[model samples]
Target: MFGDPIENPKGWPRVELDEVLDGIDSGKSPVCLSRPATPGEWGVLKLSAVTYGRYNASENKALPEGTAPGQNLEVRPGDLLFSRKNTYSLVGAVVLVRETPKRMLLPDLIFRLRLGEPQMLTASYLHQLLMYPSKRKEVRSLAGGAAGSMPNISKGRLLKLRVEVPPMSLQEEYARVVERLEQHRRLIGAQLHCLEAGLDSLQATAFSARL
Candidate 1:
């Protein structure tokens, strides 16, 4: 985990994405409302959903009425998502969806990554590996678009990228470390929220007393 991912220091077999997966899946992009979808409504995912490593279900637009949602492209928990088009820095952005809301569909700009039969790698480990600085640079190099336009990575070019695949046990071990770090981060976030709430309440009481 400390060395370059592409180096394959562990001596694992490095292969192109096409060899490891059947194919990448993408969705359609229909004209959608500017507002986010409410409960029970259909929505299309926004690029911001994968702009960062974190999955944000709220960064989506409500699908226009009369437009049938793409059931085949609906995102689900444990899915690995990738952005094919975006700013130079985010052209190859990737994210792992831990959980997702119902009735949500992916946009054409985003593709859902699926591992092939034999399940050579875990989703979490793969997601982390892709985000590694060295690997990201390689992924970004595959993007090509006219100047002044958004950089885009074609599915063909992306599939040609070769990556190292470690043993399942090693992948699971790294995933456990990631989960522990996430849990600690969540705990800190909750504590911050409580402290902020208390500060807000205190400020409101102080203002009221002065009135």
Candidate 2:
């Protein structure tokens, strides 16, 4: 999507989020069940399913019997999801869906963003921008609710947020950097797991020797 890669352009233009969104749709609640539903039962997405720049479809809960998910509620890869209501710290979390192994319906408190022109705003780019610490803080500041209850950001206020629109080339570069960093993080995590296993084995060996 890069157009003749320009080097170090001046300031990027700013655009209101509403200008880029075709529509914002919230999810519906499925019947609440004490435990997870079977494969044939309805499954509803949890707000935790979407964290900053990450989507975990597996975090969904199973809905009770006789519950039905709304049409098109199932998340597709590349969909931009936003948390409409949550605790103060998580009120405005956003994420981009990379994959979905099973069909899971979105819950009532999450909003799905449909882009007006997909090419104009890359999902990866937008997700990264929203995940920025400063931007997230700004979002949290906009949230309003009761004195001792969950906070909520209205759709109008959320859509009114101004975002910087950098060149598509730069956005693509940022996406690549994020991908590399994620790969490195995974490698480090694996190494840590191995080290923990080694330590456990050493402890086991020492205990056996004492026996």
Candidate 3:
């Protein structure tokens, strides 16, 4: 029942990620016992940084000096981060770094990708591809473990992921479309949160009046 699909869409290129990328790496775990750092330092990003296909800076954790640099991994703006271990639905969640403070670090369970030619593969496109249902299924299948627990995708499997690349212009266009959709989703989410907060406040106020 599968329909015939175009092998290569016009203005698109068929290429694997390894072909156009350099230095695909993940972060190291911070030492829990490390001392705290002074003010004005870098923060460490956990899987919590990524949510619903976006980066949430509000939830990031600050790193102490011992885990800041020469002790922990460093990340930068424009780098792509992926969740390596999480709930089935959260696994493979991706985010594009929009800003970088000094000594930014990623936890061991997350991956950081540094693109060789940023023009060739836009971070937005990569994020979309990884979030695709088919790709997520593939990642889940590769995950090894017992049922009902967090599963992990090995480094070898991650590097071997096949990515279909579109031309830079088309990629940018797709990114814009995805971005618009994401904005709408975020708006809806905010509205829901506000509604929930209002309901909670009303309930509390009513209870207080009765008291």
Q: Which candidate should be chosen as best, given TM-score against the real structure? A: 1
List per-prediction Cα lDDT, in the order shown: 0.89, 0.78, 0.68
Residue ranges of candidate 2 with Cα displaced over 4 Å: 1-10, 37-41, 51-53, 180-211
Off by over 4 Å in 1: none
Taking all chains together, each candidate's TM-score versus the true structure is 0.93, 0.78, 0.68
For candidate 2, the TM-score is: 0.78
lDDT tens digits by residue: candidate 3, 83-128: 8788877777788876555555677788877677555788887776
User: Tens digit of lDDT per residue, candidate 2, span 1-211?
Assistant: 3221122145567788998889898898865765554676667887778854578776778876566567588878778999989988888899877667556788889999888866667777887667777778877887998898899999999999887777778788878887789779779989999999999999998999953
Of candidate 1, the 10-residue stretch with the lowest lDDT total is 1-10
Count backbone overlaps in model 2.
Answer: 0
Off by over 4 Å in 3: 1-13, 32-39, 65-72, 100-102, 146-149, 176-211
Over the stretch 65-90, how does candidate 1's per-residue lDDT look in tens digits? Answer: 89998899999998899999999888
Residue 22's lDDT within candidate 1 is: 67
Candidates 1 and 3 compared by TM-score, better number = 1
